[model samples]
Target chain A: MTSSTSRAPVAAEGTRARLIDAALDLFTHCGFAGTSLQMIADQLHVTKAAVYHHFKTRDEILAAVIRPAVEDVKNLIAEASAQRTPTARAERMLTGWVDLALRHRALIGLLQTDPAVKPHLKEEQNASILLDQPRDLLASHLSGPGRQVCAQVALLGIVGAASTPELRELDDETLRDLLLDVGRKILGLRRPRSS
Target chain B: MTSSTSRAPVAAEGTRARLIDAALDLFTHCGFAGTSLQMIADQLHVTKAAVYHHFKTRDEILAAVIRPAVEDVKNLIAEASAQRTPTARAERMLTGWVDLALRHRALIGLLQTDPAVKPHLKEEQNASILLDQPRDLLASHLSGPGRQVCAQVALLGIVGAASTPELRELDDETLRDLLLDVGRKILGLRRPRSS
Candidate 1:
């Protein structure tokens, strides 16, 4: 057999991703608890053994799906950390965070709401660190105690706006305006958009 | 042999509410697919058999948990439907929504995220109608073309702030300001916290 048939998936476009995509679709629709290995297998038309050959269990699969999404958030934090200006950093962070959230709205939705996984997702090992990085970076430049809270709240407000299906009904332009408008308010701002 | 132990749990609390509570706790912590009846049973100090006796399957348990939360949102919609003032109705709707959400943040969190049970929670017969209530309420008051979308993004922004751990981390006063501010901005208010 060629190497393609023999290699285990560990790249951007591999069996692992395919499994995650299938699982995400099912998990999004059926629920994480509602979905099964067999279901994932069924979605892919592959054997459960084949699915297991990559992920040891469902939790591992769940973890795998969250990793890329979590990394995406981490990357945003990294970009935010790189900027020197508080205004630029805050603006970049908000835009990056919202874009990532809107792109992976489903995963962000799960992170925010899914009761069982919320804590697990936020545990120190997972997205918790990713979450804190921004807080820490923003905190470094912030002036007062309430200011940190404001920044955190502002960024989260943007994420929530981007990820919520209630917001999904919005057209892109309206959504962007709402996000930017809401962002300014959270930051205790009344600046014109072009500012 | 008197069945006293069994009777206490049965008669003292409504079985439906108990099951919903247990499932909500587990669902919030584990993600729907990750949670099991045994886990819910563990929380309730009952057996899987008892859980099954109450809910035919985990799906039913999931349904029961989201039902009340979703209904609360629907009630807000009805209440908004009765109000004549666009601003007042939006305020009333937002107020009722915040009150309802704050009461059971965890359940609302679960209903919002967690891919496992998301589909089932939307309800077949009355799907999106309850969701549309706020959008409609917003559209009635706001005359813009994408007002519906604006309303949705705003509504979600409130919900996201209300339930997020990010928001939960803030002191009550700050959290409240952020939420109200975001809401008013969504409504396109000139001064976000007038009331």
Candidate 2:
């Protein structure tokens, strides 16, 4: 994973978020192929040219969803990275990921299934902005090579949990608590040995 | 919630299994939209009309996929119900479900996200295939309602756990063990009742 070494992280601010929020509404309403640049332009109340000024193509907008999922993950990890203890940092990172997954369920589903949108995700490289952020965040709090692999797998498990239909029906509070419970189980962060 | 009160249990077993297996292969390969009834017929080495004779439309075949994900859950519960001990039954059901999910990852994915497939799936009633199955399976074992609900959620959490991309990469033995560990933690099955 390139981590932060390659791209200076893009903050989820301004035109970037406008493009994302617009894309989210359209993609979820219409299947990805059914959505078009013209629709996005109209969604933003901007002309096609203005939409292009921000994102050159539909793929650009598709790539933008990864920004929020990745950024939230990065923020979680970034906060985790600053913690003094490895265990505390991991617990925070794991719990935060579950919370984010539950909160941003639809967006995560878009990024997961739409084949058109997945490649732009730089999960292995810094490009997998969605995955790498949490990965790097969790890696910082761990020591062994195996732990990195576990954290990477655990991150995907968290995404899968929150994104799946079974998890989707539960109310936010229920979902949040279940995910936190699952996260502790995944990390095997035993209570007391826990956060 | 009606556990197929119909005495026949699975109607037309041979034909239904053939249709579902063929659909699973084709749908996973080409996705729901990309496939056609003719392709399913061709794969089965049967005429298209014969395919229709079994399944009325492409939606019917998509509907068939739902059966396995649900039926497996039902079967797991049936077995658990047979066991007299509560902890033993809960263990049997959770462990069995993890195996089933790993064995059928592609179908599970299709049941999950393939937009073309999900709508026709009738997953809401079938959600009981999951929601109610474990509730019954653990009923014999758990004394309290909260613990029973937790047991059911943990079983789905096992379903959730098996759905991960990284876990998908691991061999079944390793994946099963990892989920068992999580199951123990989530259901409070492990000694010491840690996280």
Candidate 3:
């Protein structure tokens, strides 16, 4: 009985994880608004009740699916925010941001571009605001007119290129270097002297 | 009777224009798959029959809505391709492309990023393939490794910044200059000395 009791939570966790996996695929292809609980259940070869037993609504599943990435971004931003100088902060944020984006390319792409997903991502976890903090910090490092526009477009190039599919074939490391180069140029930063 | 016949065609054209406008707005917000003809009709305060009369399917409406922009891009590419040198070609393509994206910001954004909209943009009008010609031309002008990546990311920045809502507050001319600057820097082009 005790073994069964312990196993129940583990099995439930497994099911939840699988459900999230299916939902992410569906959400990426079908979009958040278009995906339903029944579709997720069918993808899992389970019944609707089983999906409901875990996530009561599609939004609940969305929250669970994106929570890890969002938390990571928040943490990254917090770390980037603590840097002493604009250059250091932008560098840390740019590298960290590129790594996170490459690791979670499709998910990050959906989060950035999906119209239906935005409303569900509350203020603190909002992708736009999360990105804006670092972008604004990066912009502070630039001088002259239209600095904010420069920083914003440069950052978009990084996130956009990382998440975009055309560059997907470039492999993670190569793509990362390319995106970092693009970002630095747009923001008017020189390549590190050591490199 | 002849005047009435001409007026009838003009009125139909007007209705068609209005339906396309409504559909574009709906598709942008609700996503193509998530939106229904009925919802579009409701948005326009018309019967579903009215929408159906104009477009038999949502895809038809989507095609019509984006047709003008697509034609403009194709024409721009043709114009850019006619330039004598790589610099002139890249310059023409870059400037024309940014102007088109800025003019049809939301529509271009949907075309570029929306998962649901891609399949509808078939062989000739494919956004990826259409953008590739210019990117390849620009990359050829660039030397060293990762030249393609540099050009691709630079082009993405121009389109992405124009379409993204965050940078919308910058007047069109300012945004245009900033994006061109970003694109030029990444592509390793110099500021035109005469300017």
Question: Which model scores highest in TM-score?
Answer: 3
lDDT of 2 by residue, B40-135 (tens): 767766566666766778887776676666667677778877876777787777677768877777776665545555446564534444566665
Worst 10 residues of 1 chain A by lDDT: A1-10
True lDDT of residue A76, candidate 2: 79
- Against the reference, the lDDT scores of all candidates come to 0.66, 0.63, 0.76
For every candidate, the chain B TM-score is: 0.79, 0.71, 0.80
* Of candidates 2 and 1, the better by TM-score: 1
Assess each model's interface with DockQ, reporting 2 decimals per model: 0.21, 0.11, 0.40
- lDDT of each residue in B1-195, candidate 1, tens digit only: 221136345643465578788788888888888998889777877666767767778888877776776677777788887887777777777666656656767876766666566546554424345556776775566875446655665665556556767557766666666555555656664442655
Query: C-alpha displacement of B195 in model 3, angstroms?
Result: 7.2
Give the DockQ ranking, best first: 3, 1, 2
What pairs collide in candidate 2?
A70-A130, A121-A128, A122-A127, A122-A128, A123-A128, B86-B141
Clashes of 1: 18
lDDT, candidate 1, A70-175, per-residue tens: 7777788888878887766766676666567667878866655554565345464454456577655544445754555555555555665576566567777667
TM-score of each: 0.64, 0.60, 0.74
Best by DockQ: 3
Off by over 4 Å in 2: A1-67, A77-89, A105-182, A190-195, B1-19, B44-46, B123-129, B132-153, B190-195
